[model samples]
Target: MPEVVFSVDQSKSMRDQAVPGHNRWHPDIPVAAMVRPGDEFRIECREWTDAQLGNNDSANDVRDVDLTHAHML
Candidate 1:
């Protein structure tokens, strides 16, 4: 398996990761990892909504999710 450069825990929010990710990208953000050409690496990520929507028949989570924090990263 490729080395996990940036790891994420699906059970938790992106902001709760070891190296938390931001909701939006910016050039000022520090590089999370570096790799040379041909290098293979893995980056685990959570859902764009940070799992705000759960695995259930009810759409309450989706309907009530805060749009202000739509994307996790």
Candidate 2:
């Protein structure tokens, strides 16, 4: 599982605050910190396309979204 070692940006300007469901990314599950230089972990990701974004969604929708976070084992 991923662990927090360094730190995360919780500042008002650094936050990714957006509405859920309407957007694929945003209104994120907040986390603080990072992993070390040598850490036991793997990053799993997914790809969301136009089918997921719909016609009204814009590029800016995911621009401020932060996908980095720690996962529990």
Most TM-score-accurate candidate: 1
lDDT of 1 by residue, 1-73 (tens): 9998888878778877778888778998777788899999998887777787888978898788888877876
Those runs of model 1 whose alpha carbons end farther than 4 Å from true positions after fitting are: none
lDDT of 2 by residue, 1-73 (tens): 5643433232212223221112223445444334667777543222332122334577764664444421211
Candidates' TM-scores?
0.83, 0.23
- Residue 26, model 2: Cα distance from true site in angstroms: 9.8
Residue pairs with colliding backbones in model 1 are none
Give lDDT for model 1.
Answer: 0.82
Question: Model 1 TM-score?
Answer: 0.83
